[model samples]
Target chain A: MQASLFVSCIVDQFFPEVGESTVRVLRRLGVDVDFPPGQTCCGQPAFNSGFWNEAKPLARRLLRQLEGKEHVVVPSGSCASMLRVFYAELLRDEPAALHAAKELAPRVYELSEFIVDVLKVTDASEIGGRPRREPEKVTYHEGCHLRRELGAVTQARALIGSAPGAELVEMEQPDVCCGFGGLFSVKYPDISGAMLADKIDDIRRTGAGAVAACDSSCLMQIGGGLRAQGLPIRTVHLAQLLDEAATPG
Target chain B: MEATTKQFTQSAAKTLSDARIQDSLRGLYGGFSKARERAAEATPGWEEMRTRAQAVKSHTIANLDYYLEQVEARVTESGGNVFFAQDGEAASRYILDLAERESVKRVIKGKSMLSEEMDLNRLLAGAGVEVTETDLGEYLIQLAGDTPYHIIAPAIHMSKNRAAELLHRGVGAEGREWDTAELTAEARRQLRDKFIEADMGITGANFVVAETGTLVLVTNEGNGRMCTSMPRIHVAVMGMEKVAPTLEDMSMFLRLLTRSATGQRLSAYVTTVDGPRGPGDEDGPEQFHLVVVDNGRSRILADPHMREALNCIRCGACLNACPVYRKVGGHAYGWVYSGPIGAIVTPMLTNLPDSRDLPYASSLCGACREACPVRIDIPRMLLHLRRELAEGRNKNAPVAEAALMKVWRLSVSNSGTLAAANLIGRALRWPLLLLGRLLPPFSRWARYRELPRPVSPFRSRWKDIFRT
Candidate 1:
């Protein structure tokens, strides 16, 4: 099977390791991974910020980039949702972009979803992850768009739960947002910070070695908070957590 | 009563600093939210029920004028007065004029958010009528001189000791230590008298069944019934959109309402008042006046995008489900309604330009949409309000923001512009980290999280990185 990577603008620019892990995991599963060059952002930040007009062009660009790919894997849930769910809404006025988005949506997948649903890799070890030197604790933070928009609630957890190298601590309200809501984190910093504090507290209570999630934006938020709190916990993407770089054994 | 929604950020900041309120707010998830989840899970075909209810509400709202006229005819036939109040002032005028004519000196209330919307208590007191809030939560908050911290749990932000202190001070009780039970008992005792002595009772309508001309109030406390049955004159005010087409439709609404509001199969009292005392009625109010309030609802109903907001049952399931509401609590919303619903309702009902910050208060996490029984897409409404703000359809359209978003639009209009922008971003990344802390909006983000340094744009390294 072939999967064209849509390295969402965040994974593309700020978190290349996440993109690398995603590619490696797909490759290890005997699925050919291809990076479509013209791919840029799925235009979520603007789309979410109510600048749908600003977002529509980017959505058009992406739909053009992956019009006929067999599978388009996005590392970020928010970006994937933009392609899979919101692109149609953003491009409804333009008949051509709208049609292309509708055609391309079923092909688009968040990484964990592609692995579990499309690739049918139920266990982490099947995709290059081996038992670690010691068991590491990892809790999954369900990204809102990933869990709610894509409705892939248990795929990430199932993969993590089945990882022999790691123990899933299952933090309280794992589905709660980490409050890195694009411009929201900046717009309402106090409320965002308070929510982030609660999320950090939940992660701390689990005593997890790392917090795993599909989207880099959430990982960035959690990772930054952990670093700020002077905690040693790692924030691993679902792809990174399943990759050999994070696999100890 | 006055719209202070403009102070949302400052109020939210204040709420965040207060540890006590924060601790209290945290309980909403476990107490109300989880219970709602359990109730929905336990119910058979909860999703289908929500869908069916949404369809009924949508139909009822679309043909609201027809149902409303049906209601007016039936109500008038039953010898009850029906007043179409254009706004809060009109509602107040009708009620106050009725109060003067009836020589009403005491007024008792059921838990009515519309009462808050109308500023009824202050206006009545100013008219020299003794107005007492009959709902325990409403009474305590009124006594403490605080607005509702929540729709259902009016005093949720107030600690037990604080509630006791305020109640003792306001109720003119002897200063002493009090627990929840004793304080509740005292409030009951005080309000019990007001219910009996009151000449007029004012309540909010939960749902008005048009087929039967029935006005309903769903309350956990029995005060709603007391207010309805005990007074000589009973007045119910409601937003014009809350009409259920039939008693069967109302039953479906009842099923959705209690479960959504407090996770109960049924509240303690479901008081359905059809009209004033009938010819042979044993015990009920002598006179009934149904004041149907518009208060900007017509404007909302005309707008296709925002009309869904009127479908809100005021169940407050959205408030419990909101992360932003959980953090900031109700007062920060700066209006009668709060949380995700308030964010849209306040701006539209009051004035968008006045309550501009309310729309921007959320992270658009969408928990509210999931929790809404009628499925009001709150995030979509917020986004619409944001777009309106961005467009500056109203006078105060933050023009500065338009310039920045335009630049952002230009930068990411295509792959090449974005890549070029990325180059510029890389050069300025470090400077952003430093200057970001000093700036207004960037500082909001950088103050909390350590900004990641920009790496080489992925396209720049794609060929080398992808080669095996």
Candidate 2:
């Protein structure tokens, strides 16, 4: 089955490697993937900041781009949530936009969700007939939008647990927000820093070599914090880890 | 007591840096939240109970006028007086006038958040009526000349040593090394005399039963019972939305309230005061008064978007679950109500412009919604308030923000403009990184975390793969 990849704006601009890994993982799993070139952002920043008027056009633009794709996959949970959960609410006044959003929502899926639910692949052996090389230790950070909004809690965890040689060390409150709430970190730096401090401390206690999350936004925040502290821990997107496992080098 | 909500940012900064407050907050975070989770797990059909409570509150709020009139009629028929006050100042004045008319010299109070909302103690004391707080937590904070740091646990921000010091200074205790038992006994000993000597008693109602004209109060301390029973004149103040149509509805709320607030099956005391002492009653107040204060709640009730906030039972569950409140503590909210409930209610009930920052304080984590007993959509309401601020409906909207959002909308709407911006961003990554350190706007982001450098845009990398 052919699917359209919704590479989020953050991954498009800041972390293209995550986008590349997402494409490789989807292609290797025997699903035809296409990038809808007209796609940009899901209008979360404007919508979340209470600028519904400004966000509507961006939502409409996305609906226009992804218009007839049977399956749409997003690597970022926040952007996927914007399309699947918020678009209809954001365009309630306009009938056509609302209808398009409603129609497109069921087709939208986060990356791990698409892998586990659609492709029925969980571990490395299930993909491309290869055993995986796993790091010494890894933990998963559940993004807020993925876990709470889309209810994608167990899919990513299941994949992480089944990675060949990696030991899954569960951090304390893995579902707690990573404090990279888009504009929140920029607006309230001190409070954002305080929350990230706690999150980093929790991650350190797990003694994991790397942390994995579904969304690139969370990885960037977690990676930035780890790098700033001079910690050697690595941050990997779930798609990147799955790709690493599926195509062992 | 004063409205410092306008200074939320400054106070939050101060609160974050204060080590003692953070320590007390850490202790509170574990104690209250875990107990609540355990209580919810142990209770069968807790979710069903919450739904029923929400329905009851919705029905009552929708028919508030009918139930309020029913309440007034029943109380009047039962030989009790009812007063309606439009705002906090009016409510305080009405109580002060009543106190002066009745020649009340001393007054004792139970733990009443409504009284706090009205700044009643300061008003009453300024009017020369000596008001004594009877609840243990309330009494300690009162002695320390501080407001409540929490709804259920008012002095949760204070340490045991701090409490001992406050008591030693206020009540003339012997020394500072007082244990919990010693402090409790001392507070009880000191408050016992005031409870008896006070000419009037004042308390807040958890729910007002309209059908039976009964006022229900749930408190962990027995002082709620004493505040209603010991004095000659008894007055219970409540928000206009606190009425329940029947005792059956009251029971459902009672089940949800205690479990949500303190994770108890029931509080230590559930006092039901119907009216003054009847002809054959042995011990109770002679005169009973019920003051229903609007104080901007009616305005909130009138607005369909915000009417859900009135369904709040003041359980403080949302506060314990809120991550922002966990970090900044209650005092940073800078109002009577703190945490999620405070964030919504303070601005809506008071000046929205002054308290605009309260709604933006949250990360919209949805934890408050999961924890609310009546299912109040606090984040949605916060967003609504943010929209109001953004649209310049409230005078506090920053013009530069609106313009920036407009520019962002224009930039992101077209794929070409977005791609061009990304191309520029990728090309200038190194120079921009250097400039980011010197600029204040970018420096804020770089203060605690490294900024991610822009990579080749996805459109450039994906052209080869999709070309085939």
- For each candidate, the DockQ is 0.66, 0.67
Clashing pairs in 2: none
* lDDT (tens digit, per residue) of candidate 2 on A58-166: 8888899999999999998888888998887788889999999999999999998998998887765576636556456998998988987788889999888887666
Query: What tens-digit string does per-residue lDDT give for candidate 1 at B325-380?
Result: 98998998999999999999998899998888888888777899999999888888
Model 1: fraction of the reference interface contacts it also forms: 0.58
For every candidate, C-alpha RMSD to the true structure in Å: 2.0, 2.0
Model 2 DockQ class: medium
| Model 1 residue pairs with clashes | none
Q: Which stretch of 10 consecutive residues in model 2 chain B shows the poorest summed lDDT? A: B169-178
lDDT of 1 at A118: 89
Score chain B of each candidate by TM-score.
Answer: 0.96, 0.96
lDDT of 2 by residue, B1-468 (tens): 688998898988998999888777765546777678788889899999888888989989999999999999999888899999998888899899999999999999999988998999999999998999999999998988899988898998887778877777745544456588988987888888998898999999999999999999999879999999999999999999999899999998898888888889899899999899989999999999999999999989988878999999999998888878878888988889999889888988887888988888887777788789898988778878877777646645667777878877766677798877777877888898988877755687797788888777887889966547
